[model samples]
Every structure is written in structure tokens, then in C-alpha cells.
Target: MTNSKLLKLPSQRQLVDRLLHLIEFNHPFIFLSGKPGSGRGTLCESLLNGLPDTVRVVSLIGSAAMKMADVRQLLLQQVVARPLFNPQDALADSFFRMLDGKPANLLLLIERTDELPADLVGELWALCRHNDTLASPHKLAIIVCGNDVWCRSQKEALKGRAMPALELEVAPLSPPEQRIFLYEKAKELKIPTALLPKPKVEEILNGANGHPSAIMQSLEDIMTDRRPKKRQAELPVKKIAIVLALVVAGLLGLSYLPLFDGMGKEETREQPQEGALPAPIGSDALETNAASGAQASGSAVNGDQVARDWQSDAKTLPKKVESETVTTESTNYEGRRVVISDEVVEKLMTQPNVSGALPTEVVNELTGVSSAGATQKSAPATPSAAQHAQPSAPTAQAAPKAAVPVAVAAPKVALTPVSTLNKKPKNHYSIQLMGASNTQAVDSFVAEHALAGKVWVYKTRFRGSPWYVVVQGDYASSAQAKTAIRKLSPALLKGQPWPKSFAQIQKELKQ
Candidate 1:
């Protein structure tokens, strides 16, 4: 017996016992199957040694090249031990003659039966089917051993046959069987057990994944110190240094971001009109100027000289800072001396915080100039707001006087460009018109489309840039918003409006 037969693990031993039981009970056909490296052949050899001497054993190796004639010749040579002139008729004759008066059964072991030609395999199945018909005193048991391929083909061959074939499969080594196999393999190689610690043995068994051939190869590699050791993965030193440098540079750049934030607010401040006066600097200065202007209200002041002095001093002050620091009353001084009274100051104080160029009628009254004279002399230098309002005033004045109370009874509206959709349910849908990086562009779109109070504009970032999106919404669902697209003005429809859910907008806002 070789070392392979000597090392019969628990799984192999179980298969051997089952094979013996099937043969003892006179099973006509037996199909033994296993995968490669599962040690099925080794188990068969071990079973051969334990059988009695009276039993006859004929072993054959199956291959694709072997024909029926070749099989008969091989069988004759093994049974008769002499060359037969004609083995065709003697094939069955020899088998019956040997077992005619025998008290023992014959076991035919064909290994690697899956490699045989397709027709030859069919012939073998035919032979097993006629096992009971032979005129012999003892029975003949046919055992075909092969991998999973042969097992499937044999099953297909016996689908409707009356004869039954016993099938057995050899499984892989279990955890305990793997440990014993490794220890025995190491002993066979004359390697000391002390050299293979328990931890290394367990690792090798796991690495082999229950394959006996792999376990043997791994054991040989360890014996010769050819196995590579496991090492921790490491990054290149230059790559580590480069990554750290980039992180530090990014943090330093972020540290200077606040300085540029204030710069945008400075650039966005409105520039004063060309002939405007510089507003007084402090509250104390404004009180002093107001008292003097009040006394001059009763007398006629030189409006042209006052305008020249105001324009001359305006050049010395920063134009942008004057807008942020001045009150509503100071904004009225536009290269002219305006009458200042207690009642006028009180009314100005009571007005909402509004900032823009005054109407031409108001400017003409304060400067004490005829409408025709001011239009001809300073028409080019006049503020665009005052010029725009001049064409729309006649329409307002022509309305019936009774409409005044109706205007006062109307509800106040929010005209700011920022979206009111934030207060709505996040799941509600809206129609998106467009997006812009500047809020001014969003405001201009709303005004140009005549959708001042009908749309929402909200701030979000797009590809690392500040973005504002114009949307008309508060629809209960996306389908309703999509249906509302046709109701928009023709100018708005040209921008290709699309519907979006407010839940998505809220997510972008958080980012």
C-alpha cells in the first residue's frame, strides 16, 4: 500500500464502507463520482486491499481512444493471462467460465470512465443491464469510477432501465479531516511537526480551501522556506508628502475667503447719480444742516450756488459709502437746496425704507426750476429712474380720484426676489424657469417677465459656484406644475420651463 492509501481520512473511510456494503449485497451496477483532487482513486485502492482473496478484481483505465474491441482485448488479457487468437466470442465466454463453479463474485473497477468515448460508455451500461441473465453460479458487480461528468451521463443511460445502480459521491475534507491530512502529509515528507506551529497549520488548511493537492503543495513550499510572508501595504513617501501639502494649501485658501466676501458687497453698492450731493457724514452734522435748512425755508435761497457747492464737496467723499451711511432725507439732496420743515422730516421718517432717484416733479419742486428749463439743461445728466417715471405719471394722475381708497385697502405684497417656497412643504412641486449666478439677473428676469410676485428665486450652488434659480411654484404636485407651464406668458415659455419637486430644492439648499 502506498502513502496515499495509508492516509484514509474520515470522509474517505465512510465512502469505502458504503462501497463494501453495496458489493456484499450483490448490487449489479455502482457509480462512484467525485471532483478532481478529492482522493477518490486513493479510497478505491484502500478498498482493494481489504477484500478477500477469493474475490476476483479486474481494473481498467478508461480513455477516449479505447474502443469496444480494445476493451475486450484488455479484459481477455487480464482474465486468461495469455494471448487469445479471437477475443470477440471469448469476451463473455471467459467471464462465465471463470465464475461457472466459483463461490465468489467478480468486481470490475473502471477508473476515469468519463474520458471514454460516448458509444463505449453506452456499451458498458448495456453490459450492466444483462448482469442477472448470465448463466453463472456467482454474480458480477460492475463499478465505474469517474468525476461528476461520468456520473451525469451514467444516470441518463439508466433513465428507464429496470436494473438499479447505486450512486455514491466523495465529498471534500472537513475541518477536522483537513488537520489530520496535513499532519500525515508532513510526517510522510519527514518534516518535523514542531516546525509547523498550530497557527500556521490552520492558516494553510484555510488557504488550501479543502483541496488535498493544494494542501500538499503548500506544505512542500513551507518545508523549503519558499513561501512568501505576508506584509502590510504601504503608500509611497512622495505621494504621502504631496497629499499633505495639498490639504494644507486648501485650508490656507479657505482662511482668506471672508476677505473676498466683503469685496462683493462693496462692488455691488449703487453708484450715486452724476449731479448728486454728498450726504452729511455723522448724525451731529445732519442735525446742524437740518436746522439751517429749516430757517432757510422761509426765505428764498440761492439754489444754483448751493448746487455748485454741493457738487464740489461731493468729489472729496467716497460715493459708495454715502449710500450706506445716509438717511432717506439726506438722499433728497441732488445738487439742489430743498426746503426742510418739521412736518416734512416727520413724514420722511414715517415712510418705509425705500431708496432710489426721486420723481422729476419732486426734483423740480425742490430745485425751484421750471419743468421745461430742467428738461432742456440737465436732461442727459438726469437719473434713469426719474426719467422712466416721467412717461408713466400721466396714466396714474388720469385715474378716478375714488380709486385711492381701493389701493389703500389692497393687501401688501413681498417683492423681494428670494423664494417664498422655503415655507411650503418640501414635497410640493414647482416650475423652474432658469438659474443665474448673480441675484441681479434673477431680479431682472422677474421684472422683465412681469412676474414680480408670481415667482420664487432661491440661492443654491452649482458646480462650486453661487447660483440663483427662478421658479414659479407652490403647486400641490409635480403633475399640476407641469400642466401649468402653458399658462405662463409667451416670453416665459421661450425659456423652456420645467417642473421640479421642492424636496430636491431643499437638499441642494443644505449643501
Candidate 2:
């Protein structure tokens, strides 16, 4: 129906004109032959539209099961403009005789004569020839339309009976005519011309085989299935939500970065001293103690001045520690409590080696560690030791350290590999979807179609270059493969995929 207007193009105008002339001249009999869907009925309809008012037209469909009596009954019913309740066989003959006496011409249009029985067709032609020989005042013309089979049958009958009849054929559209027809249909459908690019148009043309009906169907399919291009402003809300979720997840991931840093650092344990401040927890606590020790050492060079300064600092340390200490039962590595009493302070002040910096032996006795780097700084400050140690005490109350190693296992989904397709029997078939120059293009195509892990891609040589071919499911036979093509998505269908035997695919794979 979409191609109805295309049947009247200039390429077919002459055929319509010829048929009209033959009908007007009262040709005894005319045979119109064409392949099914070549527009035979459409051409005859055009002729009927242009006929004169005086010509009476009666159209009938021929069938293999129809008898001459049935034909006569049908014709009589049309002539009388009423149903035949109980018509006699001779009634049709009487009607024809009555028509011969009138001045008006009678035209009979029979469609699908290929399905009519041989005897029935011959009888109809005999009636037309008899009417011609009678030279009646009213002329009669019979125009029959059929496929190539009907044309051959009629020709043989004519030779056998030495009958005269005009033979005309309705041909398929030529290549140029087909192109014109497609462009016209595309315009009628309001499809953009650019959508029908040269390669795509060529594919459609080849697939349709120049049939007007097929071409029109293909164009209509394109118009129906065309997808609108997505714009940034029109992005789906789901995708935006997913992106925001990922950003939140990334922020959460940063919290675990410190754990990895902790795993790589060497763990050292320090023994708590009697009447000393709590041991450090995190690196921040260690750095605070180091800074305080350095400041204390830079104050003076004489041991007496340092002891006077130290004594004043030592008296306030225990009070500060008592006020800030956050008590917890677990205090081994993460938190420590140590008190430095007046006895240790007096002992340190009495030593002559305790000058600008505390002696290394005294520093190690209090701090329980000795390093070349530590001897340069003054002993850890008495007041600040308790301040830094309290901040790290809360870390001991956190979840157990063993829980850090507990990780969630990633999920796994099973997928059939593409390479397994090669082991299939040679007789098995598959739909070849597309071919690409590189595997990335094939992967992109699969991912875009949401076909990843469902379809298969294999390498083959094409035009002497490495080519990747994507194929659909394996099928037992080519017919099954072809049927599966119809079930593919519209986007995949546009590529014009075809069925191929595994034998052929494997042969190419070997190359």
C-alpha cells in the first residue's frame, strides 16, 4: 500500500497506456503476466480508472476450484445486480446474448488466472472469441491477469487452438526506477535523506531485489525503527544517579588509605617506664614529642640552668596527665600510662652529664629506646608527653586491629568464552552480525548492543587484513539461524545480518 503511487511513475506509464488502448479497441482477449507483487492488479486498476463511462467493467477472482457453472453463476449475479438464489446454467448465456443487442461495451477483468483450472480458462477464452466472430453491436473484451505460469499456460492454449490474444507483462522495477521509488517513499515518510547513506541504500537495494513492494516495506521499517540520538541535557536520571553514587563511594575509599600506610611501616614496641608519661600511639604523637625535645635542648648550655628549667616543667607534668588521661583497660600498643616521680627528676638534675641535652643513657632509661638521632634532642618534655599521649588513647577503643584484614570477596559470573564456538560441529550454523577491522570495534559493538557475554567474536582474514567477526547463538541448521535473525533487536537488524554455516566460518578462521 505504501508503494501505490510508485506504480504510476513514468517508467510504467507506457504499459498503463497500452492496456487502456487495447481495452478501448475491444481486443477479444488480453493476458497480463507478472511475478507476484510486481503490481499486476495495481496496473489493471489504473486502466479501469481511465476507462470511458460507456464501458461496463466487471472484475472477478479466478480459483483452481471454480467450475464453469460457478463462473457463469457469478457473472449472471453481477449482471443482474442481485444474488443468484437458484440460477440455471443457461442464464449466463442468455445475459451475454442480451448484452450483445445493446450499444454499450462489456469489459471482464479476471485476476489470478494462474489458479484457474485449464478447462475453465479455455471456456472463458472461447466465449470471448465467439463474441468477436458474431460481430455484435456491443463489443466484449476479457482481460486476464496472472503470474508467469499462467502466461505459459495461456500461450500453449493459444497455439493449440490457433487463437488470437494480446500478451503483456508487468515487469519489476529497474535499478534506476527502484532508486527513484525509494527516494520518493523516503520523502513521503518524512525520513531524512542523509539517513539513507550510499552504503546503506545499496544494502537495502540489494536486499529488496528491486521489488517495489519489498523496497517500500524496507523503507517503512526504517522509518518505524529509527532511534532518536540522545543529548547531554536528556540523559536518563538513572545514569546520573549511578555517577553520584560512584563519587560517594570514592570518598569512602579514601578512609582506608591510612591502613595501607600502616601495613608497610615497621612496628616497634616501647616498654613503659616507672613514673613516666604514656607511650605514643600514631605518628602525630611521636612527632609532637620530638619537637618538644628539640625545643628544650636549644634553651641553654649549662646543666644548672637546664635543671632549674626542667624542675619547673616537671612539677606541672603529673597534674596535666591526671586531668587529661582517658582511662581504658586495653593500653598495650595503642595507649600507655607511665609516671615520672620526683625521685627520677632529682636523679636527672644531680647528674653532671644532663647539660643542654639529657645524656643518652638517661634518655634511654626513661624512654626505653636509644638511637643516634635521639641524642641530639633534649629529653621528651615532661608536660607535653601527657598532652600528646591522651589524643591517641581513644584509638585503643576502636574496633579490633584484626578486623582490618577482613575483606569482602568480589562476585563472579560465569560466561561462555567465544573460543568454544570453534569446537562446534561444522554443520551447525550462526548469524554473522558484523565484521570489524579490530577487536576493539567488535567489543564496542557488543557492549553498545548489551550483547557482551551473550554473543561471540572470532578473528578471520578479510581482504588480506585481520578482521573480527561477531556472530549470534549457535543453531542446528541454517533455517534456525535465519529465524533467529528476525528476533534480533532493531539496531542489529539494520546491519542486514545473514546466516552462515560453521564450516564456512571455521574455514575463514583457519586463514
Candidate 3:
């Protein structure tokens, strides 16, 4: 077993030294308890390595073959057939039976002893402790390995007669340990040194959390692929050129299109033509002379121009309509379209304004009435009635009142009241408590020293001031704060004295 070269295990140097001492002193039994993966078996191997070749090692990893009869048979085979079994009971028995004075060195290593019957383990320990029963002059040593739960159970079963068990705990590796582990794994994998810089190597190690298995696996992944750095060099320049070219083309296209000029001219044309009447004639003559007459040409030209203007105006109409719709929809106006339903429109004919009050021209357009005579006859009387109804044109006199000066009350000064101004706000005091540039550190310190439920933390800032962390109304006074400061001094300012008062501390925070 010692001839097999194994990788050195982590964190068992003290155990190895103790075991060596035990073996030299011929101590009979040793029980070792540790967490899983705590290198118990490795320590045993180290002890075996220090021993002489004449001393044989019998390693029984616990299994179903742990009954007393199986133990006796195994002992018989080792002493009679092999004679090389270290700590062999058969050899001890045979020596007592035959030679009775022969000396030998025997070491027995048992792994996972918790699986063995409780009675068998107790009996074996008793035999090893009392070597006077056998005549052999040889030394006997037994080492047992098991995890915490199993070891605890076994100890409880032994009822205080068991050998003293040494407990070992395996801890996760620290940052530096992780880096060393990664470096070793990289060497084993024959990874090229230049592929990763020292900082990058440290990053990989930190990412693996110092576990040997994780470190090796990460190193393997890093070694399998080599990334090239040169591919990144030309990418930024290419992207910048593409973006600049697109921006330049967009600006040039925008410069040639006279967007506002065309819009202003179209507005001027549509406003003058909006209420103008169409050319009128008898239907028979209009249809018969539509292709040949000069009057038809004029009407056709006007209609074509109006249609073009309408199309252009339609493009700009959405802005005006949307503005009016948004303003009216937001108001409390009741006459506006509240609910546009199919049923409402079907009832439109029964409404009061359906024919008479509505403008004849608008009614004609909706009804598809082509008689231009009806529109000319109705237009003159409609405005006449509207003109005669108002006895005193109150609209002329009320127009200025409609403007109503809108009182525009000089935009209220909105000064903060004198009473509010007089009281120094809590935030002002808080800002003074929390020091500039060290607010987070101060907060953490306060939290660490605070008694769990007794203290409450608050943070605030005044206008043009730095933020602060405040521990409000301490149950204990300044002396208590001083005591807490002393206790936490190591974690704070290297055992320095605390500020004398809360106000002083707040001032220091502001500074």
C-alpha cells in the first residue's frame, strides 16, 4: 500500500504526526471522526508509509463481512496462510500456540467502522487493549475512519469503553488556497503559461471557490480552447464609420425637402376655399356639356384643385383634430360625443337638428341630394333668421368679457411658511450625523453595534447637503455608545475612542 504514490491530501499534518506517535508507542486502538472528504484515509496511509516493510498492513474497509465469525476466519487466513497480516489476530494466536515469544509489528486500518456490529467492535477493542491473553510480543494498532454522524452513533453504542476519537473538520479553501489549487491543476494539464495572465488566473480560481475538483475542471475547460485577441481590433472602427455615414445621408435628405414651406402654402389655399359654393347648372345641360363647354372646364379645374388641396389638408388635419379631441375629451362638456354607438347614429333622424337646424348644405351632402337650387334658396333665409333673432347683439358687448382677463394672478410666490422655515428639520440633523463620503461605512458600523430590536436607523439629507445614518434616541446613554465603540473598535478605527456626544458625532459625519 505504501508503494502506491498518491497525491498529497490537504490539512491532516497534525493527525499524521499523532498517528505516527501512537504507532511508535504501540497504542492499540484509535478512532477518528471527521466530515466526509476530511482526509481520514489519507492520514492512515501516511502512517503506514512511515512503518517498516516487515510490518504488514491489513486494511478492512467495513462491509457486510463484519460479523465475529467472518472476522475470525479473516484473522486465521492472514496469520496461517500469509503471515504478512499486520496486527493479525491469527498470527498472535499462532505465536501463542506454537512459538509464544516471536516478535512482529502489525497495523490494521478499518474504514467506515460504523457499519460493523456494535458488539464486535467493542470486543475487538477489548482484545487489542489486553494483549496479555496472547503470548505474541508483536505490537498491535487499529485505526478506524468514519463521518460525524456514524462516529457519534458508534461512540454512543460503546457506552464510554471506546478509545478516544479525534474529530477533524474539513473547511472550504480560502481565496489564496483556491489560486494555488488552480495553478497546480494548470501545471498537471500542461496548460500554456501565456494563455491567461496572473490576474485572469486569479479570477478563474476565485470563480471556482477553492474546491480541488472544481479547480481542475475549470482549468481543463480553459486549456481546451485558446481565444484570439486580434479579432477585436478592427471592429469598433468599422462600426463607427457605418453609423456616421448613415447619419450624414439622413441629414442631407432632410435638408432638400422644404417641409414647413409647403405646409404654410397649403394652409393659405385651404382656408380661402373652405366655404366657397360649387358651380351650379340644370342636370341635363351640365351632363350634356360637361366635355365641350368652357364653364365645365372651369368647374373641373376648381374641383381638381380642391381635391388636391383636400388630400394635402387631410395630411395636416390629424394634428388639429387630435388637439381638439384631446382638449374636449378631457373637459366636462356634455354635448360632445360621449359614447359613439351604432344605435346612437341610427336614432340621428329622430333628433331635433336632423334636417331643419342643421345647415342645408351639410344635409344635402349627407342625403346625396343633387339639387343646387334647394341649397341656394335655403342659404339666404337661414342667416336672416339668425340675424333678426338677437334684439341687442349682446355677443359684440360680451366678446371682451369673454376674454375675461383670465385673472393670471401673478403666479403665486409659493414661499415656504415662516413656521416651517423656523423648525430645523430632522434631515438637517441626520445629515450632520452621517459623515460625508463615509455614509455606508457609518451605517454598517451602527448596524453592527446596535442591539437587535432596540435601535432604529434613519437616513436623510437636507437641500445641498450630504446624506446621513442616524441611530435615534438610544435606550442607553453616551456611556453605552462609548462601551459599544470600545467593543467594535477593532472592526472600526483600531481601538480609538468614540465621539463624546451625538451632536459631536453628527458634526464629524458632516466633515
Clashes by residue pair, model 1 = none
Expressed as tens digits, the lDDT of each residue in 1-511 for candidate 2 is 4325754577578887887787777455778888876777767777887788988887888878887667677776665565444444454355665454555577888898777655556666666655555555356677888887768677666633234776788777889888888888888888897789999899889987766777777887787875455665766889989999999999989989998777665342343446645333332322335566556545543323331123333544454454332334545666665555454566677896665886655666467564333332343555377447676666554334323342222332232454686698899998989988976677667767777667777777888999888887889998899899999889999999999898887788779
What ranking emerges by lDDT with the best candidate at the front? 2, 1, 3
lDDT tens digits by residue: candidate 3, 108-135: 6777777765555666555564464455
Highest TM-score: which candidate? Answer: 2
Local distance difference test scores for all models: 0.68, 0.69, 0.52
**Cα lDDT of model 1 by residue, 1-511, tens digit:** 1435334666677777777777767655778888876666776788787776767888898878887677777865766556544545535555556444545467888888788655545555555554456565355677888887769767666744466776787777888878888888888888887879889888888887776767888888977988788897886999999999999999999999999997887877765557756443332322336565454443332343222112234556565553322233444667554354443345456655536865443455456655455434433555575548586666554354323231112232233333555567987898999888876677667666677777766778899999888777678887899789989878888999998898888777766
The C-alpha TM-scores of every prediction are 0.39, 0.40, 0.33
- Which ranges in model 3 have alpha carbons more than 4 Å from their true place? 1-10, 26-28, 64-72, 82-101, 115-120, 132-138, 156-175, 191-511
Compare the candidates by lDDT and give the number of the best one.
2
Off by over 4 Å in 1: 1-8, 63-67, 83-104, 135-137, 159-162, 193-199, 224-511
Count clashing pairs, candidate 3.
Answer: 3
